[model samples]
Target: MSATTDGSRVRNLWDEAKAATLDEPGKLLYRSNLLGSDKRITNYGGGNTSAKVTHRDPLTGEDVTVLWVKGSGGDVGTIKLDGFATLYMDKLNRLRDIYRGPAHEDEMVGYLPHCTFNLNPRAASIDTPLHAYLPYPHVDHMHPDAVIAIAATRNGREITRRVYGEEIGWLEWRRPGFELGLELARFAAENPEAKGVVLGSHGLFTWGRTAEECYATTLAIINRAIEWFEGELKDKPAFGGEVVAALPRERRREIAARLMPEIRARIGRDEAKIGHFDDSDAVLQFVGSAALRPLAALGTSCPDHFLRTKIRPLVLDFDPANGDVEALVAGLDGAVEAYRQDYAAYYQRSKHPDSPAMRDPNAVIYLVPGVGMISFAKDKGTARVSAEFYVNAINVMRGASGVDDYLGLPEQEAFDIEYWLLEEAKLQRLPKPKPLAGRVALVTGGAGGIGQAIAARLMAEGACVVLADIDANALDATKADFAKGFGADQVRGTRMNVTSEAEVAASFAEAVVEYGGLDILVSNAGIASAAPVEDTTLEVWDRNISILATGYFLVSREAFRLFRRQKLGGSMIFISSKNGLAASAGASAYCTAKAAEIHLARCLALEGAEAGIRVNTVNPDAVLRGSKIWSGEWREQRAASSKIGTEELEAHYRNRSLLKRSVFPEDIAEAVYFFASDLSAKSTGNIVNVDAGNAISFTR
Candidate 1:
């Protein structure tokens, strides 16, 4: 919901999508994200949506049947498949021709299993063809609150006419189905270069072939409208006590968490994961108070909002200890019904035979008695988006037309988007797995070559990593080097003993306190001890287990606890040696501890999976020459025993596997990075052999 912005002119969603078409998956993902974001603005699911797809013809010996749509019961905010209907592009293109709204659509095939619709509501989102007809590979559309607010004013139509020229077309609100989409297509095609559009008394529309362009254009128009209004309206003095600026990102969420439950309680449901979301202070402050000037209906900016934001946020008068769920629900429902009826009357006024009529309000917005205007999304992300859209909507309406002269889509026209098939498709989809963006991570023993390599890799692909180790000097030195190479404050360091509970506890506390949350843990700390079983002392055995095995348990246990509490899930990795599984004569406790560590990793994997955590191990053999435990003399001896020069010995060790090269700590680090990242999202309870291909003891 929060996007960092700089001063730049905007392009349209249509253009952005077109440029990004080559990244077919990215195009689909970005467009869907855009649409999902749009839905958030005014609770558009069941309102508006977008999609970017690759279409080919199987009949003509080509690929076809690419679709992403919002589903029947889908919300723009949390839309997934079942939210969208997939059909051959040819079929959708054909449907676009006969879409004469209620008249022609009433006779068309009703909802099919592939339609992604519930039995009661069989309407394809009206904007389906609107997206399908896009010349660009990607498409985006939104029922902006600003446009709608301006459109809904007393002099809405006149104000819109004055603010925007035909560079953006204005349409009379009409019934949605095939008809509205056709009209939109015709308008778009006519003004190929037009960057903006306004639907009289309805909403606003912007497009681009690529995500960046589309997002930019949408923001540009909305922002411009807002600026215009602010300049024209002239402030009415700061009322003595000046209004304060908004809070920072973290503080905003903190405040929202405290207020969310109270808002949810008013809506009447107690079981849900709505907490995993974001919110807007501007929206909260604006809508929370009924005392604010009530201008017009910004509830369902367009029907698409319903899918994402659930019609609109309830307007409740909340207090400190209020548990009156019934009153709250009633108030919310009553407000929503009022909105629905208002829409119904508007529909009646704007209806024609080609129009498709909807039965109720897709979404509703409540002017709460005191708290603020809450933009509701089906989920947290959507809600946050809806609030943003609302903010833009206010800006557009006020900017384009004076506060009292807003314009919007007519009821019938709004209906078409509310029931758009293509728009729904945008909602009912999944992102093509970016894996770990915006996620913070930590790598234990990260100062060494292996840890450094893994940390660097993760950072390269966009992940924040905290390099931790017990060696204070090494930790600081590593941090300095890493920070230099990456950026200021890029790699952080903490020195703590893996074997010490107090130290481990202290480290974890510091991590959680500093990073807010941790998503990855690479347990790569261990000590090597060479002793025949006959001469292995209990003290040595205990030390090995303590550092190699028990330490693993301690580190893993706390990470597991943190994962559970944070509920975001995480990944844990253990670095075991090939000796753990194969017989190595001189090492008894080392092998045993490592072997036990592997099993420990497996068991941990099983338990953590429930909480979305993953556990895996890497067996690295002969890759320890430069490790703290291995000295230059040790390396020389190992190389000599191989009957080759040191470099050749290293190459032999590396080449021992399928590839003939020495496996350095970096090689092991790569494996660790994979498991710690999304590449191994589904890979848990498994062991990766990082020793090239040394067949020490063929388990299978």
Candidate 2:
């Protein structure tokens, strides 16, 4: 509802009317959503909530206590009723009998399915037992930055006593499983007056006799920590004071745009990565501070933080005073390689005989002095969330380091959590990646039917798209539609007139900033005109050439420059027309401009061959459905020239085609998809006609 927290208070969003209409499980869902709605309260998917509810057993015909906990891989903020795993509380208690000790804790995860209640297929998470063992009707586990700050300091237990006194207790760090559950149960039994416990270097756990009480208590405890930190650290210099002043906002963005593609090109070798850049006040304050290098090296203290950000970040060697970007670029290879070696050594030092194989030995977060932070991942959402997690770590460091020594998780413990066999099993269970996963594409004229179709098709295969168009209103609507079907992170839109060189260049720069860099460029912007050569005015000829011919050149040239910068190869699909290779009466201006587009693709293809930048064209004829070009006088002119009414154009074109099929925007989109994907990996300087078998427009 409000920004996570405004320094002292976390908003309580529980409405009496809303809670009154829900049952016990519904109350738990509501409480979980209210807690998770704020980032300062918990990071995405970093917390779990549960309620011990009375349910009538289908097989037993008797009321039993069911542990309804947030399921594996579910985010509490957006979770539905089905996202919670239902388990018999009695069966979960029985697991303690076979739980041997810490060495056998992992085996307990495999036995959770035996405790399923009502056959709920949602798998239980590791935190399930922690909630099940708690002697409360409602329980919440959350990773609020303010509370973790106190929990991550060297003297965390002492600080916990100072902050909450007898209201809460503290427990030393233990990996979540059956063993930790037992420890929690023991703590609750010893301190009956305590409302919650801060797990060392981890998070906070609170309980109540009812769902609303639990939700209010969780907020109250976190808000107290926030207020305490504000009062204690009011005079302290954050991150041991700033060593380097932040660069200007525009300068920081310019540097990020320059470095992101270079970093992406190197780290994306094994699997392509999408990147996110953050120059927020918090990120800049930390990255430009005196303690940045040491703090970054020590890594994040929370397991949730390190899992997304990796054990540590690669701090780039850049000085804002000198502004020597070229030197930094030259040294990137060595810096990245060194980080990889260090990570591989960490795995080697801590791995057990049964540990999963080492994953990509690359840093997920990158720290740039005076610039900001950059994160790369298999998708835009993960990259952005990874950055958010690191920012949370920074907040913890600021509060912890200001008042006490900030301590990171032990290396061996962090490694074991990262390489746990159970974690590996979860990774293996994920769905396979789509064809265009991790790729970025820019589609000109994206508001139009053909452009929208092409953009949708590429997104279906997992490519992030930036839509550029001249119509502002249309562009916004189209982007909103696509974002709904795909996701907000997968699509963006910008207004541009493709014929203007400056606008074209700026649009490409925006794309680079939005999504690391470009991988596919669809030059589809167009205009149509019809007139006899003798009657064609200079104004008519120039207008057609400006948008259709020169516009293609401007966009193509920008794509080439970016492709060369990234060094990751690229695909450029020019949406030309059937008239490019075939002549039509009384349409000299349109035909000539279309022809120039095809030749430009050929020239660029020849120059880009050695660099793996493929160029191709998709030509379509009589695509009258939902096309902006057909909504104008061009339709009437073409219909007049063909000696047919405008309403009969679709039928005429379909009957004239060899296949007798009408060409739609979707048909053209399929052809463009081929060129944009690796399915056309070895082919370049090619043309495909989507005119339902146009004999006269055949390339051969």
Of the candidates shown, which would achieve the greatest lDDT relative to the real structure? 2
Per-candidate Cα lDDT values, in order, are: 0.58, 0.93
Off by over 4 Å in 2: 1-7
Task: Give the TM-score comparing model 1 with the true structure, all chains together.
Answer: 0.48
Q: What would the C-alpha RMSD of candidate 2 be, to one decimal place?
A: 1.1
Q: What is the TM-score of each candidate against the true structure?
A: 0.48, 0.99
RMSDs, each prediction?
Answer: 12.2, 1.1
What is the C-alpha lDDT profile of model 2 across 44-145, one tens digit per residue? 989999999999999979999999999999988888999999999999989888888888888899999999999999999998989999999999999999
Those runs of model 1 whose alpha carbons end farther than 4 Å from true positions after fitting are 1-101, 105-149, 152-155, 161-172, 175-178, 181-197, 200-202, 205-224, 236-310, 313-555, 566-573, 579-616, 623-644, 650-700
